[model samples]
Target: MDLTGTQRAGATPTWYEDALAWACRPVHHTTDISPLRAHAQAVGHTDGYRPHPPHRTRRHP
Candidate 1:
């Protein structure tokens, strides 16, 4: 990932330019929850959701 020439002369490699373009491309999101739940189940997350433990507060004398 040497970008000395690109940094100095404002020249970029084709692959680097293409990757930047692809990374900046817009992505659409799906509103369906069924597929998401199915994927979660496949990954063995059938225990539903759990919350983290509460933090303890310090007391002042």
Candidate 2:
């Protein structure tokens, strides 16, 4: 699938403005966060959220 971002010169969309629009609409059948990811995204905190980086990380030596 051609992500809207790909149409731009970047691999990913820089802002969520367009993304939010897409999310609001049921068009294009792609890019919708899965039920599982939606659950993670619904969490207020980023910890353990799949879409977000872990809240804390240990130094990798």
lDDT: which candidate is best? 1
Q: Judged by lDDT against the true structure, how good is candidate 2?
A: 0.42
Tens digits of per-residue lDDT for model 1, 1-61: 5668657477544765455445444334523222122223456554333332333356678
What TM-scores do the predictions have? 0.26, 0.22
Off by over 4 Å in 2: 1-14, 27-61
- Per-residue lDDT for 1-61 in model 2, tens only? 5557556667355455455444444333545433223233554753331342223335767
Range of the 10 consecutive residues with the lowest summed lDDT in candidate 1: 30-39
Off by over 4 Å in 1: 1-13, 29-61
Candidate no. 1 TM-score: 0.26
In each prediction, how many residue pairs overlap at the backbone (N, C-alpha, C within less than 3 A)? 0, 0
